[model samples]
Target: MTNEQANCDTMVADPVVGDGCRRYVLPRQRPGDSTGDAPRVAELKCKVAELESQLRDLRRTNDTLKMHVAKALGLQLDSPIPGAGFETTRGGKAANAVAVSRRTAPGAVRGVETQVPKPTETPTGVEFRVLGPVEAAVAGRRIDLGAPKQRAVLALLVSQVGQPVSVDVLLEELWDGSPPPSAITSLHAYVANLRRALEPNRAPRKPASVLRTRGRAYLLDSRMVQVDVHRFGDRAMAGWQALDRGDPQRALREFDAGLALWRGQAYAEVADTTHVAPEVVRLEELRLWAIEGRCATLIAMGAHEIAVSELAAFTQAHPLREYGCELFSLALYRAGRQADALAMLRAHQKRMAEELGIDPSPALQHLEREILHQAPSLG
Candidate 1:
């Protein structure tokens, strides 16, 4: 057979030709090809064109269905669908309600509607307390978080309320960078359990409002929950501003409210954990600063006796804190204990030199000289 005839034979049997028309027309048949084959080739080409048209129609129908599904799910076309293995809500409450209706009454014709009851919206009155041990409460009732590791997860989220925490970061924080093989799976389980605890009445597939998924990370919505640590910071900042503006009474009130939030040691249950240790230190320091501000306000208001009592306890608890020592000594001098005030400064100086291998701060030394000279500012 001629090379051109051989090529025609191969192209005629090609899969693309059999399934549908080739994207482009096949090479023209050889000049000597029979007239009978010409009619057969034309018929086959027409059939291929019909098949291609049908394929295009099917693809258009599929695209329309995808658009409808995206609209029903309240999802943007580009956003990825969450894993179905976890709790997956269609969109929000309204979308979920519609989806539930469709599933419960799939056979009902369009005109004849079925009455599917809507799922109850989970209440948002949740409160997280991490000023001491971590605790969660919903609608005034406390939730019994299962274990230490679970509570650690809660503490980490509460510490960074409204911020998305990646699973890798959570694993490191939970295990201090030495997680076991099952840690990732276990962390997922912890998150699921927390969702159940937070919203016991939510439907099985509904997205959680309080603890939510944001891409690969999880965020605890601050709007859905109140955290005591946040409240403490707000009050403390207000108090500091009040003090700066010379409103001692207002400053004392704000500081008292801020200090009252601490039930015990900050993040007491998880203070040593790598994730919570730094925050615990920060809060404890803020508490001490609030105490000092309150004492200073009291002294400014001529309430030296109260300042002396509070400063005495505070100084004993935090001996190396130079500012506390300074406040305590000044309170003593104001209350007519010049000798005792001078002696307290000497004791702090000696302790600093022995423990820290340094002399007292210049402010403390200057205070000592003022006391020795019986300076008028001692009043």
Candidate 2:
């Protein structure tokens, strides 16, 4: 019952310190009792260094994987990685494609894709460059479209330049049938990237709108840029309608304008895709049809001399088209060359019979008959 025993007996059990107080409590050490802490600190330091080494190795592996993906996909080495929301261009407006990586910091929302902000430039004029190689330029520069798939997306959209191309249609064209889970989201990113690149400068308070989000699809506004196919189709349709209405002079003008849009194959750089091939063929056929229409219109306008030479060359190039041969015959007959016209029709007739095992249509045969005789209407 000395002073120490008296102090212990006087202490009551507090609620904070239950019956097992000594197990949870730490003993206060004396000034010279610092023996164990240094080894514990050393162990912690070793653990940290080990973890850092593992992290470095993991980062290297990640970088290597990124390089491999980029290479396999034909992506530019300098392209913004996935989840690195960057801007690109389409029809002179800004676009944002999904970045491959958004792990700006460790454990920082990794693998979460997001739409990139649109570019902040006002387009002065959207230049539609569909004549050759099918490129788009804005601010006097060609916009960077990340990789082939993304480029293909732009190409498809541009070909449908002024219309809403549905997301499903785009997927079909982009991947045939094997689209990834992130396809739609990635498409949005590509569109955004294209917009940003098209409008790089932050101006006009709102970006120039070239692409619009329609119901479950994207619409590229034609007024936002010039499209060669649109121009060609418009003029060619006008020309054909004029010809149907018997306005030869107007038809000639329209056909001339439509024909002038043909710098080369439509969207030539995109020609390798199976999806684009049919469209290219269609455009080619349209061109041939317009040529024939032009020749017919020219003949109707009494430009027989010029039409004869041009139609003859065209028929030589496109031997299988019976209408072209027919037009050539008519043009020649009108130009006081009845014998040459009959000979040309007979040659086409033989070629068709031998190649396709088919005879000339009745209209062509009747026209041939007219050329054979000294028909006064040849004038």
Candidate 3:
């Protein structure tokens, strides 16, 4: 067929410019066109469908293998894994022409949007864990959290987690009350660097859905990211509730899971910084509480031997905390070491009186009385 008849079939559609020739696009069938084209188009469509199925399968297999590798190596990376960047480039015009050729024939071109619509982004599972050193992982790959100051900023944001932190507070904590005039500008740069690392695949100029701008404040979107500190809190709270509801087995599992997630001290890298100090202190306390709760749960399950072993060390390490001492003594008593238990409580009382010139809480005192009287409920 001639170039003029090109518009008649599903073929080339090139509009010639600066010429007097006018192209009329007839959704017209080519003179020799018949029923054969339908079968050809259907076959091509089936091939595309088959290719899509294969692509999905390959992706799943890739994910499973990466997961296994990540687990086997015990990787605790603090940086984004390289070589996983998505191909955001769209199909070329020729590829679009191919698609049009295979289906309905090309029609007279009116106008098309010049900008190619980018592919929808895949949701990345980015996990930031500050339970130990501040680190992050995306899709089983480590993400470098940048320099110390940047990591500190991340810790501050993670401390507030789902809440917005104003620019002033971040600045105050960053420079420790003596910020340079360029502190705000520097802070923005740090955030930009962090966003790049955290979202390596995020489109340019797109608003960050994870680390977001909220007026004058910036908030980490809690829904889009996972924070190990938050996860631990959730598990610990669930464990406590389970214990209260008389489900020691489930409680033990939850407590153990939360405890296992701790890599080291909370905010270890930035522990000295003002922004992280309070959070470090608070998480450390919560960890201790979780330990005591687990120990208490064990005792309730009549595992006095285990409770004695754990609480003895816990109490010895934190002697000033009467509750640990109380639990230790109780566990000793239940383990049939009545004299040892009484001596332990008496020693604590004597030490408090002599060292601090203060008395133990009433709970400890009451425990002593109950032990001395051999209260039936103590069983």
Q: Pick the candidate with the highest lDDT.
A: 1
- In order, the Cα lDDT scores of the candidates are 0.66, 0.60, 0.64
**Alpha-carbon runs more than 4 Å astray in model 2:** 1-124, 137-150, 162-190, 201-208, 213-218, 222-225, 244-247, 272-274
Candidate 2: residue 63 lDDT (0-100):
64
Best by TM-score: 3
lDDT score, candidate 3, position 204: 90
Residues 180-202 of candidate 1: C-alpha lDDT, one tens digit per residue: 99999999999999999998888
Q: In the order shown, what is each candidate's alpha-carbon RMSD?
A: 33.1, 37.4, 31.2
**Model 2 lDDT per residue over 113-182, tens place:** 2111212243545555565566677756776767777767777777665567888888876767788898
Candidate 3 lDDT tens digits, 1-379: 6543443333322211111121212233457756466754564455456545644544454345435433432223332221111111112232221100000000101111111121223266878888888888888698888888898888888777678888998998889888999999999998999889888889999888878889998888776787787667667767766654456677778889999999998877668766567667767766886887687667666677998999888988898866577778878887899889899999999999999999875446646776786654456
Q: How big is the positional error of residue 252 in model 2, measured in Å on the Cα after superposition?
A: 2.6
Tell me which residue pairs clash in candidate 1. none
Deviation in Å, model 2, residue 335 alpha carbon: 2.6
